[model samples]
Target: MNEPISWVVAYPEIFLLVMSAVISLVDVGVKSRLRDTTYVLSLLTLAVVAYLLGASAASGETLRSFNNMVVSDPMGQWLKCFAALAMFATLVYGRRYAGDRDMLARGGEMFSLALYALLGMFVMISGHNFLVIYLGLELLTLSSYALVALRRDDPQAIEAAMKYFVLGALASGFLLYGMSMVYGATGSLDLAEVLKAIAGGEATLKGSAQVLVLGLVFVVAGLAFKLGVVPFHMWVPDVYHGAPTAITLMIGGAPKLAAFAIVIRLLVEGLLPLAVDWQQMLAVLSVVSLLVGNLAAIAQTNLKRMLAFSTISQMGFMLLGLLAGVVAGDSGNMANAYSSSMFYVITYVLTTLGTFGVILLLSRNGFESENITDLAGLNQRSPLYAGVMAICMFSLAGVPPLVGFYAKLSVLQALLASSHPLYIGLAVFAVMMSLVGAFYYLRLVKVMYFDAPTQTADIVAGADARSVLSLNGALVLVLGIVPGGLMTLCAQAIAALLA
Candidate 1:
């Protein structure tokens, strides 16, 4: 008989699976009045997985288990750590909002779905093949769709879920079709082998190159839909605005890191040899996303919708580094570019979490936190909360002495150093768009400090909300002040992947 495999190798996924199962069982069998149990368990699961990730990193052992379907590598380790951290922050800011609105009754389902989604994200980060990527993507997507419709009673939530489900299905279909084409062309699902085949000119089938390129286009489109990139981002505003605040926080925060990981694996790992083709494609997408995402967001009065569009614009900025990686092949610039992209992802998660935390603090039941006017008297009511919100808005706008500024600076620097004039032009445009984005962010600040209260006199700030919001808000400033450490870690993780 074969010896049992060590469970430690698959610890990340295993932890989530165990927690999810236990939560599900408890929900079924146990009659608990405290609906927060599942949410607490979900948070604990993230903490445990985060510890495991740290231990794995400390051990410094790169292990491929289960016939190499999953591997523990530096890149995967770092991403898992980031994902866990983001999830934890999301849960912290979300639980109270859910509880207050009576959204906690079925909160266990949401938490379990989040865990499943996280398991998929973990698989995605460690994936070495197309099959694994697809499995992870599907798991993540399916769970997310359910989470969007958590409040089934609400018409808007149901509508958003419907839109999301239909659009997500179409994207998945395209992605699967593309994966099939790539498999046909390369005769292997393994990303390493596919890369080798492409490098060796072994991908020669009837229209193999075209098929592969078409497949890549479809894959990018599908992933872009997840990233909320412009033209593919129609679902974002509606979904963010309609979904519960807790769900919005989860969707906006952790999943973006997972999407970034998937992009790195698929584009950088799987299609590296086709750099010239995909680089230009990403460049165009990046430009369009930046221009359209920023311009459209400026017109949005709904806070969540604005942030949704802002997320799209941010994805465009993140793509700059990815494009640079491909465009600067063999010059070692790709490594730097990849690092910059990772750095940007981390910074963006922090800023987004803090921004949403503020929203949660201000919002009460029956009142959706969806307007800039809602923040008018925030400074007068709670100066600390207002200050934190200011920092988050500034960071999102790419202001100096903040983490977001460095993220933008690094990506633009990478783009400027690349040989492509078009990339340089787009980078400049993105910078200009950042300035354009700043106007709205600053407008919020003006409302917070200068404008008098317009919405309501009774500003409710719960204790749990204030604590999380304060920490989340301060983190933006703290990270901005001492970004070198995280930046170094991101650089190292990217370097390991490239190595």
Candidate 2:
């Protein structure tokens, strides 16, 4: 406690940075063409990183380091821990798939890049400065662009990468411009100073207030792109459909936890004074994303594309928690509302990992299980796989006895508990949308259990994938049954943030 383990919070990031370089070097000399050494080393690095972050989270220190450019607290540390572990799960579910596709043929840049991406998420989560957060966002997005095109020979992948890069660059520019405006108005690059400046009525001079609001608009737009919300969500479905399934999971899973962290850091912690304007923006985006995403998902025959739309809707749902927090400008509901969002995001990622894990397992060298029909007769081929998929689907559908149900419930509770009629109306609308969403989820389940066999092959998978997958699916069900622990953890994390 004297030295403040997370007080020196950069330790784990420094370790991850060095280990990534070492692993890359080691992969080059292996001479075996296989990436096992690189994969194993990467996993070890992530495990250690998770341990470090967990220790820091348990320490419960709200320490600011790097000249107050970064703040390490329970929320950031726990998010980092989960991000590292999610990356661990990603690599485990992906290694064989990558190997079979010759993705690791030249080397294991994928593993190293993924680690760097996690490092970026760490920076984004803990950053207390606008520029620091932007830096982390760029690192993660750039890494993601490269990863989407890792299967260089595939035209779809190459196209996806190009689209991601161009759109990502544009979003970054919007965010940077917005930050500059915010800085000009408030005269600070640090988030805390910005908040202090705004709260003190320093920006109320006519021109300054206008500029601040304009900047908030652009910032929200940029964040919408990052969160893959409506109107700014053009990149998600294409990228999700075209990238290698493993890479898709990488995009769809851990980064979301980081995205939520940044949302909390920027909107909740940094710009709470401007809540009224930004909250309205979030509400519109959430409603449109829900409407578009679910309707589009039902039309998709391809499993990946369908899930891509699902991601859009789910993200919109998560935003409900954020927008609900500042109702009537009262900060009383802030912790509970944001904590529900935190829990929703964590559970969403958990379910996403298992969902895509099943996709990767069904895929092999000559085949990609890209279509929903590919899942037909899954129960007949492997009941274990089918059951896991079903659990994830049910969770997504908000069906009972699964994690997704509780996640939706918590968000709804946060909404309904509010005094605002608008929030209650949105809650009802969300329930109706959930009903629309259930059709697609249940359709998948029906295809798995009742549809006629399309292929006679029994499913094959490595021991590691099977074990992790079982645990992942079990958590979805068990957490649904008993979500108190995680709910408490999320509430505590948010308390640290708000404190």
Candidate 3:
């Protein structure tokens, strides 16, 4: 008898896929420069998908579908749920901005492409096999390249897209080469089978241990590139700087959750048997990312570029949690450590949304808010937007009582809680990096508050964008104050992953 493939386990991906095609078709008939029709439909699609993922997560059932090539688990579901909501918010904040820049003048391609990119992220999060994961990643990256080049008339956008495409292709090649080697060693493409092959010493006994290790290095290198960590993060600043601000958010925001998902799926779930080897590798990446990201950010006049480096440093801190998960070969601290990283990523995304929302709001027709000085006297123009931006800045700075502080605290706690000398030392080093990072974040705040307004034009935003932006900022503050609910959710989701 043939094995049955469970199609129902991937309800959200199915819905998203179907809706993306439908939306694309529907967009062909859309003539509005604002893309209102496609925008509304896309929002509805994202909302429904998010609901489905949330409902599935709430059910707490782990199911393998498509002959075990796809898995629906709490960890995946929660991440998918968040990614969907982040997409929804991105559209909300970027809709008017895109329309203003003629991004929607031709059709609703941006909206549809965004949905496609999100579909890619969904696949990435839910994929249970090496091929599936790589396919998902390609889908997301390819869509992103097109999205970056959407402003075909802009030379900078085209240049950035070219850079992104070239680097992204190289990274994909690294991952594929690594996957092939891994397959040669383990004789399996399925993550579970790969895990069994490695953990059971099948590869070692077959004299493929060295090959597996070499493959792991390439895999980690590919993953590091995807995560935009140091040494592999060349594309981050240029892409963030060159792309339209709205496109920047699309690239920077939700894909992070998906990136985190793949790290877990590939490293934590598949090759955890070799934690000791990967652990040291991750530690070095983390330390270098913190050093380079923070220091380089200090020299940036472009807000987008600064945030890009900030992202690199923030990811470094999250990686620290992953490294601390395995201490002296004892898996006792695994759940807490990974959960802390999860918490950090979620909170970071939430803050990024708010920060970018403000930037989008401040930008008017013929004016792009791309520089630090663009925020000067923002408080005078609109206190609400200023407050939102300030909150985001403070959160990103890891200032007290904000969600970012707690996010950093949780990661530091995970590191220290491991009771390993190296991890403890990392905790200290991370703290020092955060202090260095604060200077840039606070510098923006100072400009927003103290400097004179360069333009007296009224700050205008649609009702939807304003409401959502406010809510986004409020959540950052509220979550910081009461983080237990999210913390518990992350812990349970990670626990489910381990189980």
Candidate 4:
């Protein structure tokens, strides 16, 4: 089996790599006063990638390459498109912040790093072999570490980077150990082969099932850390709060799409035989994350910290989809549940991007825009800002007619349809916890719209920030009003994966 020479299949990753190189060269060689060049380049790169992804989707051919180490199907294509869109939004949101802070001198580096991270994402989405998956994971993890330390002068940034690096290394170790154990047990590196082996008497190997289960536990633990699930999520709050707000926005948004894809590949494709074991583990983790994330967020005064906890809770909801997809007997429901999970991830990216956009807009030099108090009397000071923030708050609260509401509803629907009584119980608990989550989001709305302005401070929002914020904020409403298009596409992607 030789690798396929499918130019169209490789176009998206090729474009990203080329654009990243060109942008880096331009940054190093060109001495221009206009800081917007990097921003423009990033936007152009994103547009090109999105166009290529769309073309690939329209072609409707699943392309596998590198001797089947990589697989490009509808699901991968759609997720890559979403990732590109999210990256574009992050660039737009970060533009003003980067420029105003004179960070554009390094903007090319940021864009390059982001593209590299995106490369990892693409690899993760398309990977069919454990080697490919681990390679992609390392690329993403390393690039992210560099990105967190982009602001070298800030001690807080350095501290956050160090923390992220250390924890990420541990997670990688766990993932590697699991991979080794799986290889030892099954004598295969390809996901499909691993599954076939397990199904065809490989389970009879001496203690193979136990070893495989333990290996999977480690693998999930590592991935769960990336997802910010409970017990493995301690780094989230500190990193979110300490890193630059723009970086925080990036972390909170697009990465989830890639993470979700990786989970599906590893758990659904590679470890399907052990679904019963992992499903139970995920159920417990999901329940804990939901309870702890919501309850802990209530005590948080720092805006970023609160959002960090919120991210953890959101992961729990995502896990519900995974749980539903891993039922003991009914594989049909599992497929539908995976589709639901896909929908949930899409909704999450939109809602989180919009939420962080508001934070970026209000943030200024010397002020992180991180405290709930920063939003005080925002309605009195700037009704537009107040209204945008309120919409984000409502969406995050899972209020009706908004994107977040649909996301939560979809996941819960998947959970409810599961045959497991405990899964249903957990779903019910998630709904109640969501109600509690609403209180804090509402509190922010109250501060923004009802409270009095403590002091009139000059808010300096640059053009890039303003443009991205307006677009991001409007997206929440637009998606809420007419979600059918994206939802239909998501359904299609999910259907393809199961097919």
TM-scores for every candidate against the unseen true structure: 0.95, 0.98, 0.99, 0.96
Residue-wise C-alpha lDDT for candidate 4, range 98-181, written one tens digit per residue: 555555564467778888898898888889999998898899889888888878888998999999999989989998899888
Residue clash pairs of candidate 2: none
Ranked candidates (TM-score, high to low): 3, 2, 4, 1
Winning model by lDDT: 3
Off-target runs (Cα >4 Å) in candidate 3 are none
Model 2 deviation from the true structure expressed as Cα RMSD, one decimal place: 2.0
* Model 2 stretches with alpha carbons more than 4 Å out: 1-7
Candidate 4 TM-score to native: 0.96
TM-score between candidate 2 and the true structure: 0.98
When 2 and 3 are scored with TM-score, the better candidate is 3
RMSD in order of candidates: 2.2, 2.0, 0.8, 1.7
Cα miss at 18, model 2 (Å)?
0.8
Q: Candidates' lDDT values, in order?
A: 0.82, 0.92, 0.94, 0.83
Error of 2 at 452 (Å): 1.0
Instruction: Please list the residue runs of candidate 1 whose C-alpha ends up more than 4 Å from where it truly belongs after superposition.
Output: 1-7, 29-34, 58-60, 205-207, 455-464
lDDT of 2 by residue, 1-499 (tens): 3333344768888898899889978888765555877888998999999999999998888888777888889999999999999999999999889988889888898999999899899989989999999999988998999999999999999999999999999999998999899999999998999998899989786359999999999999999999999999999999999999999999999999999988888887778999999999999999999999999999999999999999999999999988778888788898889999999999999999999999999998789998999999999999999999999999999999788999999999999877799999999999999999999999999999999978776677889889999999999999999999999999998998898
